[model samples]
Target: MTGIKAPSKRQLNNYLYDRRREKFGRAAIYLDELEKWIFDGTTIPDDENEVFVFSYHVIEAEEPSFRLALSTKKLLNIVCSTDILHIDATYKLIWQGFPVLVLGTTDKNRKFHPLYLGVSTNERQEDFQMILMALKKRFCLYLIT
Candidate 1:
C-alpha cells in the first residue's frame, strides 16, 4: 500500500508478448509506412534517398524474407575509402529468427564503420549475391574510378 503498484513480472511479460504479436501481425502496415516515409522524401538522408530493397523473396505467394539496405553518402565514401570490406552475420536479433547481415569496413585508424545492414531469411549464397549485386550497381563507378 505504501509503494506504487506495478504489474507482476509474468503479467508484464504477457503484455509485452501481446504487443509484439499485434505488431508482427500487421507487418504490412509497418512496411507500408516505412516505404511511404522513404519514398515521399520525409526520411531522406543528406538530401538523398539511400534506402533500397536489396532483395525480396516470396514463396507460395507469401513474402518470407525482405532485405533492406541502408546507405548514405558519407557511409558510401567510407566504404570506398577502405580497401578491405568485412561482412558479418548475426542471429536472434528478431523473434522471426532472420539473420542480420552487416557490411562494414575499417577506417585508416582501424575503426570499423558499418555501411550496409540487412536482414535475410537465410544465409544462402544467392542472398549474399543479391546484396553484392546491389552494392556493385550503386558503387561501380566509384569503385572503378
Candidate 2:
C-alpha cells in the first residue's frame, strides 16, 4: 500500500468497541470496587454526600474528521449520583485549557456506557451545548420517574 490502509467498517467497529470497553470498563470496575469499599467501611467519608472525581486522560483523538490538531487533548470525568453515575466527556482547548463538553449522561448501572468516544474541533460550542441539554433532560427524567 502506498499509505496507511483504512480500516474496513467491521474492523473499525471492533477497534472502537475494544477501545470503549478498555476505557469505560475500567471506570466501571473502579466504581464497583469503590462502592464495595464504602460498604465495607474500608473508605471513610467526612460528609454524607461523598463525591469522588475520577478523570482519565485521552492521548489519542478518537475522531480525526473533527479537525482537532495534534495539540488537542480529551478528558473524561465520572461523578457519583444517588441512583446512577454521571459521566462527562470533553475536549480541553489547547490555548485556554478550558473543557468543551462533548458528552454527558446519567447512565443506568451499566447501560449506556460509551462505545465510541471522541472530541471535535469543529462545532465545539454546539457539541458542548448538546451534551449539557442532554444531561439536563436525563436529570429531569430521573427526577420524575
Candidate 3:
C-alpha cells in the first residue's frame, strides 16, 4: 500500500495558490467566452491576449446570494488560511430558501486543498457528501487518510 504523503507547509500553500489561480483563470475564460457569445453571437477564441469585457451581470447574479448564504453556512476555517474553491447552487427554492455550496481548503498558514463544503439550507448532509466525494475523486489521497 502506498503511504499518504503530507505536503510541507510551503508546498501545500503553493499547491493551493496554483490551484486557485488555475480555477480563477478558467472561470475568467469561460465568462469571457460566454460574454462574447452573448454579445457577438459567436464564440471567441481562447487566447491569453484576448481582451474580454467583464460585466456586472456575471458577478451580480452570484455574488450577493453567496454573501447572504455565508451567514448561514458558517463554514469554519479549519486551516490557518483558507480559500474558496467553488461556489454553486444546488436547486431552486420552494420558499425563499436556496442551497449553496462552497468548496475550499484550510491550514494554519499554508494549507493545500483542504475541503470545506457549505450549504445555505439546514439539510446539507447530501450536499456535504457530494462535495466530499468530488474532492476525493479530484485530489485522491491528498484528501483522504
Candidate 4:
C-alpha cells in the first residue's frame, strides 16, 4: 500500500456530485464541458475522442430545451443498414429537468445499438420533430445506402 487513506463514500460523493450541484446552481453551465469535449475533441483516448458533433442547438428560454447528437461513421452505417429505429423518451426530473429521447436500432443479429440521444426540457411535438429532422438531415446517407 502507498500509505494513503482512501476517501470515504461521503467524501467521494461530495467531491463528485455536491460540488457540481453547487456550481450548476447558479446557471445552466452543465453542458459547457460536454460542449468542449464535443466541439474541440479535447478528451482522452484518441480513438473514442474522434466524435463528430453533427448538431448542437440550445434554446435560451427560462426553461431551455437543448438537443445534442454524437455519432460515428460506423454507427451511422450500421443504423442505415438496420433500417429500423426505436425512439423513446425518458424524463429525468431530478437533474436538469429535461426529458431525454433516445434513438436506437438493432443490428443484423438483433443486437440493440443506440444511434443518437436528444434532450429537451419538454416533451412537445415540435421538440421531437426538430430532433428527428436533425437526425434525418445528418444521416441522409441511409436513404441511398
Candidate 5:
C-alpha cells in the first residue's frame, strides 16, 4: 500500500457525533455541570460568542423540571427594532422530549428571524408564561451597551 486510507464520511459523522455527545453529554441529565454553571449566575457575553442564557428555573423533585431561555444581545436588539413577535413550541427535538419554545419577529416581508429559544419540561400555559417572564427578565438583568 503506497497511500494511507481515508476515513469514510459515515465514520467522520460518527466521530463527530461521539465528540458532541462527549462534549455536551449523552442526555439531559448529563447537562448538570453546565446547568449548574449557568444557574450560579456566571454566564457572560463577549465578542467571540454571543450565546447567552438569560433565564432559567430548576425544580428539584421526583421528576425534576427545568425551564430555560437562551438568546443573544444582538437578537434582543433585533427583536426590539421589529414588531409582531412570534412565539411557538415544538416537541421531541431534544432529550426528555422537552418542548423547545421559539421566539422571533416578523419583518414587513413576513420573514421570520429567530430571536430566542427556550426549553420546558412540558408545554403548558404556565411553561410558556415562565419562558416569557424569563424573556422579560433579560431586559432588567442585561442592558445593551
Candidate 6:
C-alpha cells in the first residue's frame, strides 16, 4: 500500500498561522515596526480602500511625539462638505494609554458624524495644531471656499 502521512492538527495550525504572520504575527515582528505600519500614512489598499492611516506626524526631539490620524473617503467627504466642527478629547478611556481626539461635524439636528480619530503621544497645544494642520493641509482649499 502507498502511504502518505497527513499533517498533524498542530502542523496545520502552524501552517495557517505562518500564512497569516504578515498581518497578525507579532512575535515575529518588532513592536516599533508594527507601530510604523499603524502610525505611518502608508497607502494600504483593499477592495473598498476604506480604513487607513492617512496622517502620521512625528515631532523630532529627544523624546518624540507620534501623532496618527485615520479616515475614510466617505468621512473626508463629510468633513469637506460640513462646517459645524465638533472636536473633543476624551481622556478617561485611553487607547493604548493615550487620549483619543475626535474630529467631527454636528448637523442642525445635532447628529454627530466622526470624520477623524487622532491620537498623540503628548497632550499639548502643538499636538492639537499638528492634527488640525494635517486636516487643513488636505482640505485647505475646500474649507476656505
Clashes of 1: 0
Candidate 2, 1-145: lDDT as tens digits: 7899988999999898899988867423333454343345423234333332222222234542221111111112231233443434445433123343323344556555331132333455655454444344433322211
Model 3 vs. true fold: TM:
0.23
lDDT of 5: 0.74
By TM-score: ranked, best first: 5, 6, 1, 4, 2, 3
Clashes of each: 0, 0, 5, 0, 0, 0
Model 6: worst 10 consecutive residues (lDDT sum): 40-49
Computed on alpha carbons, the lDDT of every model, listed in order, comes to: 0.63, 0.37, 0.39, 0.64, 0.74, 0.72
Stretches off by above 4 angstroms in model 5 are: 1-28, 40-42
Q: Given candidate 5, what's the lDDT at residue 117?
A: 85
Task: Tell me the alpha-carbon RMSD of every candidate.
Answer: 5.3, 18.0, 20.5, 6.9, 5.0, 6.8
By TM-score, the better pick of 4 and 5 is: 5
Candidate 2 backbone collisions, by pair: none
TM per candidate: 0.61, 0.24, 0.23, 0.59, 0.71, 0.66
- Better structure of 3 and 6 per TM-score: 6
TM for candidate 6 is 0.66
State the lDDT of candidate 4 residue by residue for 66-128, as single tens digits. Answer: 666666555555565666888888764223566667779976788877876666666778877
Q: Candidate 2: which stretches are off by over 4 Å?
A: 1-3, 26-44, 48-145
Most accurate candidate by lDDT: 5
**Residue 81 lDDT, candidate 3, scale 0-100:** 35
How large an RMSD does model 4 have?
Answer: 6.9
Q: Give me the overall lDDT of model 6.
A: 0.72
Ranked by lDDT, top first: 5, 6, 4, 1, 3, 2
As a TM-score, model 5 comes out at 0.71
Error of 5 at 115 (Å): 0.3
